[model samples]
Target: MSLLFENAIGDFELSTATLYSPTNGDLEATRDEPVPIDGIVEYASYHDRLDHPEKDDWIAVPLHESDSAALTGEYIAFTDHALHGEIFVYDDGDDYESIDRDAFVESTLAERVRFWHSDYAPDDPPSYFDSPIAEREPPRRPLSGDDAASFFDELESFVRAEMDAQRDANGEKAAGSTPEALREQGFGAIPSLSSLGQPEDGTYRFRIDDDGDDRAQDRHRYVQREFGIFEGNEVQLFPPNAERAPDAFPIAATVGSIEGRTVRLAVDWHAIEDRSTVGGYLRQKRRGYAVTLLLNSVPYDRELEAIARVRERDDHRALLTGETAVTFGDTAGVKSSQQDVELNQEQELAVSCALLADHLFCIHGPPGTGKTRTLVEVVRRSVQAGDDVLVCADSNQAVDNLVAGSSTAATADERSLHAYAQHGADEFVLRRVNAGNSSNDVVGERYATCDGRADVVAATNSSAATLDREFDVLVLDEATQATCTASCIPLARANKVVLAGDHKQLPPFSATEDPPESAAGMSLFEHLYADGGVYEGVGVQLRTQYRMHRDIAWFSNRRFYDRALRQGRDVASLADRPALVGYDVGGSEETIDHSKRNDAEARLVAHVVDELRTEAGLEAAEIGVITPYTAQVDAVRTKLTAQLERGREVTVDTIDSFQGSEKVAIVISLVRSNADGEVGFLDRPLDGPRRLNVAMTRAERFCALIGDWYTLRDSRGGAGDGTDLYDDLHSFLESTGRLRRVEPEFIPIPE
Candidate 1:
């Protein structure tokens, strides 16, 4: 949430109706999936054009229709430029008649886009069956490669013309040279790098997206796989040596062009018949290459049998044996925090579980429970005992947070006494720090080398996956937020694992399915926590929370945590804090808006923020507005930022944003207000408690909850079909006199 307001969406862009999207792909496909675009914009104006950005230039396709009709507009002359990536326009419809089919087949440029349709689906494949792409169909005819060569030529012309218009950019800054001479010079300077691998039977492609030549490859073969180095715009030919790579560069032809860091080029089959060209940068592409190998190279046969026996509790004989916790050395237990602070009972127990060499440990860290602190100490102690440690978290912030702690742990005390070994050949190069004083530098580009190597190798879960070295311990903080598969990535390199998270806060974040049925949605922490009391010693609960006041936490602790959590002693003065209160607001619910935002509720949240500041004597720093929905969060943020007075630093965010931090007063705006007791996604019977638990427990002096009590109290599914944990919370709050009904603030109509 902080990232949204501070770095991403501005106040106006946060309006419920504003659209958003991403336009980039991940460098490594196997390690990180490409980010998907979202919420379509209504139109692309001339200002959106890369070459001709004037209002009169781009011809609009249609107000509501698709871009396929762009050529029918008055600007048919500009269609050629758009076809070859030379200029941008309002729509991206292509001209299928312009492509040549035989040229495409000659290049083995087969495509699946036009070849198949969704005509093959199952009637019932059973509840557990989950296919990656859902369904498959027989092959169909693909597009042509004939038009692709012409498109690149047109693209070259577009690039030269745009350079002339933006005189200050590219080679245009000079006034001496004619546009023709500058274009020639610009085209000549396109950068090129050498290729790698001792010239095996490796094949590359000349893929121009939307061009008929863009083809799909057979994924079943490893050598035939395409890494897609440069935006996939590649070209190639066939020869006698195509059957196997030659020992030297065969007599070949190559074409190259450059625009900034990307060197756009095409090489013939002759060039790839040898590797005397690009080797260094090609080797750096090892990130995703290794991930693919690791995933496919699993010892399936042995691991499957071992897993079955272990699961049935019959024989624990053989799995991938090596660095089990029992074989790994034990810790001498020399650990300390940033300031050498003493650990509370809860922190002590959490750290003790990790040092005891348990195969698995579940550390329940509720809001402000110092979960990261305990995990840091565990890693430091284990490393001091002469064992390599890999600390991982699901998000980048959490990963950097742990590294910052370890950086402090290493520099603040006698951590320098131990000798450290860099994990692999490269020093954390998968999205790494450029240069800085410490590990925090690893984030956001400013970073330094490991001049001062910390005791542990820390990174986001997948980022550290390239390291195949065995480690003594792997601590996963905030484990419940990651899917079971994501959390297990560290287990592949560790003997023992520790899961530190509270499933009662937020489960795995899946944008697709609800209550994720796939293995990716099942969280490891959730599984171990709910697997019965057999996990007594392996699970340690951190009950003392420093975030909420005693009175503020009374209801949530008793109702959510089974009364196990306590307020820290240092904050004992706040024990007499006003009890957690709920204002029903008789908040009327609309018939569940599909847009997932409520402007009226957003204004009400701003109204609550104003009332608290003026009536309750609280500063903006003490107030926070929280919602469960992203759209609602955006809506409320827009209201507060645009309407609130200066110096009002009130933050508006979601549960994930406030997970590790807290404010004096937290106001929750339950966006769902349906009168039918349909609480939308937030009211899911199983996930309801996690959302409510984190929301209600983030307050220190005051907890203000504004929602439709009638609807939220139902504890049922979206359609009121099933019951859940919220039912019990509603009963407890009503019985204890903590619940009350109120009205939404009255806003006057404009004259």
Candidate 2:
């Protein structure tokens, strides 16, 4: 059998050692045995067991035959005395096999046997063992670099020769033929430069000139007879302006025959530049010429007609020898000329939107302060500047909110930015930055080109490494919630940056040790807010609470807001917004206590479904559920699935899978574990607080939390606090009405 061995190891070191071919029952003394070593090929001497450990005791050896060696019927075989019994050889029709004490082996050598050891060990064999030798016709040498190159050159010459012979096979004189005759012969059928540029000898040098006033000056010049088709059509000879040199020179021009007109030609300036320029510069510049090629025309009459049409409609004229065109705005329309009206200062997002041009703008407001709304408007204006923008969030829910809110007014070209989340790159210059599945590696790889390549790139602190690339503008949403490492790096990439978030809702995770002064001091928020005056001086603070009901906002102010006020923060100002209203679901602790766990969960799920189905009237797809722990996630998934099976249309997902996702309504299960038997919330190390926040907030139209308030409140206080867990829970229930007990009521799961 003939075999070819190609080395697949790209750059690893190669070695030589004894090789045993189990298939042919042949043993070679060294890697280069019977053949000379070539480039990157070497003889193996020692095996590194540690580096290449075998899963089993068995080891495989391979043998290669020389390409030039011819196979002969004659062969030889030999064996060592390490066998416990007699050895037998047989040709299995498919391949040759050698059996020694029931073990199989095949060899290329003809029959011959020799034994050196008396006893045989079937399980393990000694390292050194000599067997047999096989000889065949001498092998031929493989192709060399020079030989391969020459072969390809000869092949190309032959192909060209054959094509030319076929062209002239009709026994008709084709050289110097008329344009119509060339057209009939399939040489100049098209009135474009492509047809005219066909080379008689497969080679041509041509120049087109459309700038000259006279008919003769408009035509193209060809040094070789191969470009004969472009003889008459001047407009098709060169690009709009032949003298307007490109960054890379030497454009290729093509010739063809036009109906009525004798000849026509076309110039592919973009193609010429693309083929000549190296690397990314060519791709960036290709866009301009691609547009030009799509509009180019051939034939003098057609060219003149097109130019006249453009002139009649607008004050546009062909310049630089028809290779370029210039235009002046002559038409007057007030609406078309009007610039975008900036939003009023009273608008909640006005200040943050205005700071899109600032080198750095940090927005720190309490919860319900309209940070997200401000971010959306700023992103809109940033993208309007023809800049590509990337928007990313630490959580999937954040990404979803940004995408959904921004997609409303996007143009067809702008809508393409949404693909960055799925593809990890954007075709449109602007895209929402997404660290898929919380993997920073994806962000790092894609951000390498985020500078001028992308209009905007947004991601969380975990992906801060991506900010290593430079950017024109940067916006950090939910800034206060991010850790220092996650928030600070992206600032390095942007000439102008915006930071918007509520500091009171959540502060950066405190570091275990004080960081060095030179290290930018912990959190990006702290770095900005270190001096209270700096935070107050930067930008606008929106106090509107549009998300919550007025009553809820008012009540929350007295509870959560008042606490922040005690710390000298301005969180209580949102109570004035008329858009905020509150709803009260009357219930008592005794009523809630009588409800079973399953009944409580089911009632909650049904309430959410009914609200989405009837009250808010939202689609089933626009609702989600978030749980803090995997155990709770599994539990909720089961109960929700059962409810859904019974005809409810709501969908439930875990916090981990729900990142970068959004829904109109969300219900969060803050499963408080009593693993330590404490009355308050357990301070268990849980995964994905950021993920939980992202998921819970993503169902933006409405949100609800269901959990043990007491446990959560107690957990918030460090172990040093003397307060009992139940006391913490009472305080929590009084502060925020996120939890409430419900009376047992059998509600039908929505179908």
Candidate 3:
């Protein structure tokens, strides 16, 4: 083998070597194979394993000045003890295989030194073997003048954080444990060696031995914790026993499909040398053998690949630099195509500019502003003009909304993409790419099975990576909830891009507690409104909102949208009702059992929910209770269940989970009512109370905020904009006769 393409670095005894591959895309474990090296390796100073003496597998191979320069690239080596190697290969020159050379070298230097022994050939046993440092700083974005590194860093942080959070939420697990021990702890395990088939045929099947109590009975029970797992979820298949096969590594695979108690995984055959060896290894004890399955929810592997491809495009830089910015109405000189549906002036302008743009276009959509409908119109025109369009959203629900239009009464007359497709106006291929369990799967098969003949494809941003074909236009929905790095996944596959979202609502869900200005939590939609952002001079704002009453929409319009959002529906009939109301409680907020809660405020919330359902005649489904704390949500949910009539249920959730949902009446419990006047995360000092904005906008007719007025009005007085937002809210409520104060006896607080 050529030295540059060789998999082995140092010559060691084959029987004594242990191959190491990536676990969850990180160097977390070992497996079998000749370690393949595909990138350059940097030489860091080496340490002698004899100094520690406890590390028996590590034998420092002395590097001579004569051959150090020739062994610079990556390699696999073995010497005295069990073999362990790093693998980075240019398997296929596709976007995913474009190795970040700087990232590779940094990892090698930080972990351990890899040197080649010139005295021995690949077949000959050379000097001592090399062992990596026991611990390593998680791999970070390499600032190698790569434009896509920032997005990669941010997205990687989210992916890792989400995985860690999920693991913590699911309860911790031991690294190595017996099958019975794991099963006793509610973890799934497959006992007895049966059969392992190849997934190269698009579907892989496996059967477990059915004999003992440990047999595969209810396979679905094994995966009950992971039933919601989507396509491309990470998985690790562990060997029967870690002590017996210390050198054996877990096989890595991605979920393809799940049926009953059976899970189908797409194994990376290129990484594994032979399938028979894996089968033989599992068949060691036959009936006595057991394999443990670990499913990880890190779903951004393809996103990293998408970043590599987007970084190579010239339009990416142009869009960032504002050279390709296209303003609304710039289409005045361009030919306008007739659409089947009638669009308002702003929607017409948005669609026209999107059609005229050769590179990038952005629409700043406020809450309930029909942005999805406008985007659908843009897609309609693009597909009619013979342009293949790809529509992507951060969530599966958002993608469905974009295709079927937002769930609002005013939009009932609006035609959905599926409805349009039913008309057969054009013989175009429309497809939705989603997981097997998604609501859209019943519509048709995934885009991959369409035989390369799709005119329009809609999918979640992460799912868009499954597409191999390119498109003329890419329309991204719910852009505010998506990080710029995640947006690059679909952005790389299209020639021109159009994004529609409301940045004033809740920002992207982040594991980091940093401010929105920080790179850690910023969203792509927020990036467009930043200094010198693409929206600086050319962006369009959808001003009309159709979801809320005029009185209900006024607060968001004046406080968040700068009075730019106009009410689309007339609300003269709601003048007799209390549209915006606040009930003040005198109780103080306290942190109990690591959760923020106020018994007085929670009781008041239950009271309000009762009034809305019984007195106001609103159905249970038309009412929702929103809070900033999970403890508060649980408290209110419990109180409502105990106090409300039997069979009456109301939705209670945190503000973050209720962003895309709306109700006829919304009751909010600001959980941070305290003597210290702390408003907590509700009033963001830097980001302008985004959670509060979402809470207030969710109501269509009636909105009630229950809190300690003194806590909100007097809290955070010295802080910048955050304190002023609360003060303004208090002022608005008082001036409009919406603020109502109640005595302590009105709602009883539990002792």
Q: Which candidate's TM-score is highest? A: 3
**Residue 382 displacement (Å), model 1:** 1.7
Q: How many Å off is the CA of 186 in candidate 2?
A: 60
**Tens digits of per-residue lDDT for model 3 on 525-555?**
5665433343453357888888887877888
lDDT of each: 0.47, 0.36, 0.60
For this target, which candidate reaches the highest lDDT against the unseen true structure?
3
**Stretches of model 2 off by over 4 angstroms after superposition:** 1-359, 365-373, 376-392, 395-428, 431-454, 457-469, 506-522, 530-535, 561-618, 646-668, 673-751
| Shift in Å, residue 117, candidate 3 | 62
TM-score each candidate.
Answer: 0.52, 0.37, 0.64
| Number of clashes recorded per candidate | 18, 64, 6
Cα lDDT, model 1, residue 432: 29
Model 1 clash count equals: 18
Across 1-751, the per-residue lDDT of candidate 1 in tens digits comes to 0111111111112112211111133111222321111101111111133123333433221110111111111221123244453221322244212212222222211111111112212343323332211222111211124432232233233333332333223222222333234334432121122232232234322222121222332223211222222222222211223234334322223224322222233334444533543332233322111100001112122223323333333111111111111111122332322222577876875675466432566788877677777776676567655666777787766666655433432342222111122322222221222212133532333222344544466656655565646667778887888765456466656767778887777777653435554333557666444333112334668888876667667767877788887767645322333446666655444333343665666776787677677777778988888888777776777788778773237877887677655777888887666656766667565576667778887777777777666666664444653235555666766787877665455632110
- What local lDDT does model 2 show for residue 212? 38
lDDT string for model 2 (348-430, tens) is 33432233222334565444444555565555555544443445444545544544433432221122234333332333344
